[model samples]
Target: MSDSTQLARQVVQALLDAGVREAVLAPGSRNAPLSFALLAADRAGALRLHTRIDERSAGFLALGLARTSGRPVAVSCTSGTAVANLAPAALEAHHEHLPWIAVTADRPLRLRGTSANQTTEQVGLLPRAEVLDLAAGDEVDVPVGALLAARGPVHLNVQFDEPLTPVDDWVPRPTTARPPAPASTPEPKVLARGPRTVVVAGDGAGPAARLLAEQAGWPLLAEPSSGARAGSHAVPAYRVLLGTELAAEVERVVVAGHPTLSRPVARLLGREDVEVVDLAPDDRWQPRPFPVVDSAPVWRVGDGAPDLEWLDRWREAGRSLAARVRALLRAEGDVTPHEVAGVVAGAVGARDLLFVGPSNPVRDLDLMMTPPPVDRSARVVANRGLAGIDGVVSSAIGAALAHGAEGRTIALMGDVTFLHDQGGLVLGPHEPRPNLTLVVVNDDGGSIFSLLEQGGADHAHAFERLFGTPHGVDLAALCAATRTPHWRVESVAELEHALSQPAGGIEVVEVRVRRDNRREIDERVRNLRP
Candidate 1:
């Protein structure tokens, strides 16, 4: 048996020992040993292996799989540019603090400067990742404890010698997962309850954010994907309310997780008069970006009574605008993006998974959806780490597959985002497909830019060509290419009816909307204040 085969098997065993039950593989030459080993593990029921032709998609698939399963997942690709393709996903994982493992096949040390094919210093490919560079013939003494303990990205670059494939037949080994090392959690601090405060729950902010707000009688400004959004304190149209007069009365903010959705929230946080108290624990990277006056591992309400009127005023103001928002939404009868987001978001049931994309879709979702029922679970997640519209389709699929069988998944993404990784729908007939309903808000172009400053009259002339970049592709035909089911709806009634149908497998619900008048609608929404 070649040493390369032995090393690959050891690496596979290490992954299994580390409790990595899912892996994505992009076929390549040098990584053949790893691929065969992964396949063997899959056959042995040690792990589930997913294969993708595109390394980029494979990385995100692993990312979403790990995210939902709450366990480390690995994506292996060949060396050189193939390794580079996983960089974007790695960067996203680093920022999001997800443990994404990248196993890249590399050429041995002897081929470093010898013009070897597909060999270009794979060690430093993922800058933010903790790299374990393994050469051609090395012993299997890896720091499994530290690797498992790392809550961020990890890169494992393996160098294979002349024998890329296994010379001997490999049998998968069943391994038991090591018990995790225990770590101490900080005692939650107490926040004095005098000042009027609101909890700002951003992406990945857990249920603690909601419990704190509910107990203290404070409004919760939770982003759509924030796990805390299900509680009674959550304010749905928070971005709109952020512009109201009541928002100016905020004396303090108890922020958790990372908030990057609206300019109004950013401006509110920037206010020097308002005290910012962050309860967010240190992530894999830097701490909260705002100028926080107080920081804690977690926080509980102090003895003094909270300002009840402050929260009531905010809720009243938010409720007052709902009628106006509905009026405006009804004024222009055609299916609007907000309506699309609302319909899709409202359709989610208890324990259902909702995965949104970056840009307007999530923002629209934020505006139109209300909080989930307090007792039920409706898990919402996004790639809010970098918030780029990359590989979202694949991520949603990965998430759906990992989601429990009790509930289904509904994914909301824009046309551009849906198109970005639409190839995710190209699954083999034998692949284990999940029951996921993917809804695409088809505004035809980058409608998000129109709501930004670049949409002003001064830049109107260049906006369509530069920012919009409209693509006239036939989406139904595109879905047809993969033999996936698709539905295109142009009205609210049509959308409701389409959503009412039972979703069995991976399907696309393309809600057609217009890009024009987006700025006008958004301005009206922002103007809806108490």
Candidate 2:
């Protein structure tokens, strides 16, 4: 009926046109007009709208929903502090390669930063965010359509020119035309099909996993965070398919997503007959041999026929693997590796956890932590999607905030992974979270690199200088400044004690593993394997 109403309707329509099927909104006065418009759209079945009270939690909730749906979900909030609260999740989406969209109702161009009730400069809050400012407009917006063209996350800041209202002659239209979002340019695919090709999904796996498997007709294996659910796609319960009776059958394998959720399984895939392919997010293409693939699209179309029998077999295999690992850990009686794993696994709650994947830490956890004798309880997590040690800290923090403190959150990372994003630990502190833990397996060097053929090479100096960056960072000092509690443990007993203690606020457990000693233990474990 009015210009403001028409503009509001167009803005909402623009979001829907940009693949924003899901919207999470927080109620407020300044944003009432935008809120009403979105609610009307939701009621009309034009979009799925979720309402939450806390803007910070609401922002993360939108992130989690986007993660589940494999689409760029939007979070709508009122002006001033509400917009400020979204910084945490936005920061996470940026670092973890998640395409998230946010619509914030702002104060008019004049009242900004003055003594206004709910008004602040929300425009440049997230500089890294791909911001699209839509000042109340009529006619179609093409740039909004282009914003959805890319696969990553974005922010759509809606600046209403005061007195918000509904659009004139509004009629709801159903969305029918669904076009194939372009796949990230594929990197040269490596690892030819062998006798048995196993596709492994580590932590934070998206829907693209199923598509890739269907295209290649390869058997899929997924870790917890790889986002491969138990009922759909590959039997995500295939953690048992590695390092046991079924190990020989897997002649070749592709490692998609993260491998940290099931470290034992990742190690099994790293064996002589296996070739690991790292798929980062569904966007950005970069494929390397056992390196990260950033360009693979993660949309969930053509995943697979529900292979119940296939999943059953993996479930059986997982049962056996769990038993074996438990027995071995019991026999060892809190060995160094086992203790380290206990500290991590024990500290984490049933919520979400992010595991940082490097050669040494991931491999050690694979050989240690005994999977529970019963059904899987705590979901083991890792960034096996394109498993690079970079951004591990940021990813875990994002996952924690994504799940929020109501659920427990923990991150198991190496010293190197922690060092990579040490600065990220204190990012956007205004959006505080209580349920977060950081576990660093400090061995002082790139021990995983040492396990490779490069260890014995004469270029020890060069390799150490390049890969094994051992900058001695004081964990205690960093924790003190950041308000994250820091604990140092040299023995298994101390580690157990630290793990048993409850985590208040954020906790960083620094477990010191001697590099030489870790190498010796790993060598012995390899000798013990068949």
Candidate 3:
């Protein structure tokens, strides 16, 4: 073994010892010495390594691992472009506030800045990060200390001195012990109370996410991505659902880890009487009502805290939508997004739902279907992270891969999102096949725009040009092109039949909803209070 090999092993061992167990690796020769060493360690039961060829994908893969395992996860890449590719993931982590160890391979200081093949100034690249940058020549203790002390992600640029591998029989020193501390429990900091407070759960949240909101002792305002019922337009406190009149007496507002909205919600926090608290990782957007309650692991508020009763109430409220959805599906008897989601909710042994977003589909589902029946067992995931029209397909694919292992994956996305990354559909036929039922609400135009303020104004022409950006794509043909069986439903009966049958491969159901009637459907649904 050589010095480089020894250094890599020591680093890996230190991270594992420090409770960083998962590693997502991207291949590269500059980091070959470390990569091989880490791989060998994994074989030896000293670590766990998940390999991805694309650094971009690998970075997100690492994030998914960390998100699921609830532990800081690390990513390794060989030098050069691979390191740069990790930036998107790093940016996401910075925003999502996930801890990912970005390990980049570098040449010795002498070789860098001389146009060395894989050498560039890799130091302090993530200027916005709460990082502990380390050099390969530095003592193992340095990276170890950084890893142990990291409140968030760190970047480690390793410069392996020539001779790449370290001699065998060398042992890395253990991390130094910390000083003893006072044993008294610190009181939690609580925000000012409100006469009526609502906890907003963003995308990627599950029951655990909702549980956090409940802990704050406030009604939950769930986005489609956040995975909760917006509730009946009538119910007051519980109905703090969409468009509910906010209270003048409410003092504080809390936003959990979800993406910011494209359209603004109530201006309660904007009022002089209200204060806003964001529990997200980064405050870069400087979200309005902008104080941050920076809690670790998860954020909690107040003395009695968010109670189980709130979560239970939320669950029951969700089931109300589910029941209505089921009843509609049973009555309509169709394979539309509504009927399919209805059948899925009934068949679902669990509450885990993977919603795919795009212009037409999610909105249609929102208007037509009730929430899934198994609310407590349900979780909703959407890539509203950036709310881009681009990644809906890939994001859905990723979510299915993440959660489909234990529960059913019912993907409700628009034809555009489906067509956007239909390549992701390839994963379905692979061994250990993903259990995903993709429901593509095939509205020809960009339907979501019609509901926005932008939709009703003179921007109509601009809307068609920018927001609508309609592409005359045929989803049924595309589904067949992928060898995935598809159903074309024009009404409720067809949709019900498509959803009622047992599905083996990835299934795509295209339901044609006219853009003209969307507003009417939305108004009817919103007016239908239980």
Tell me the spans in candidate 2 whose CA falls farther than 4 Å from its real position.
1-97, 101-151, 154-224, 227-339, 346-354, 357-359, 369-375, 427-429, 461-463
TM-score of each: 0.97, 0.54, 0.68
- Show model 3 residue runs off by greater than 4 Å: 45-48, 130-138, 148-151, 160-219, 224-264, 272-375, 382-405, 409-450, 453-457, 471-530
Write model 2 residue lDDT over 1-530, tens digit each, in one string.
55456666777776776677777777787677778788788878787676666676676656655554456677888888888878767765665566678778876666766877776678778645877776655563636655565455576677666567654435456655244466566444433333455567655565456455555555666544454433323542254445456566665555555445445664665576654555444333233324332233332223334444444455555555445554554455434553476556555544445454455565555444433322234555554434666555645554565455455666677787787667555634434444566778887767776766676567576877776767787878977887777898777777767766747666888887666555455454443422
Better of 1 and 3 by TM-score: 1
Worst 10 residues of 1 by lDDT: 281-290
- Candidate 2 lDDT at 146 equals 54
Q: Count the backbone clashes (under 3 Å) in each candidate.
A: 0, 28, 22
Which regions of candidate 1 deviate over 4 angstroms?
284-287
Model 1: residue 155 alpha-carbon error in angstroms: 0.5
Each candidate: what lDDT? Answer: 0.86, 0.60, 0.57
**Alpha-carbon lDDT of model 2:** 0.60
Which wins on lDDT, candidate 1 or candidate 3? Answer: 1
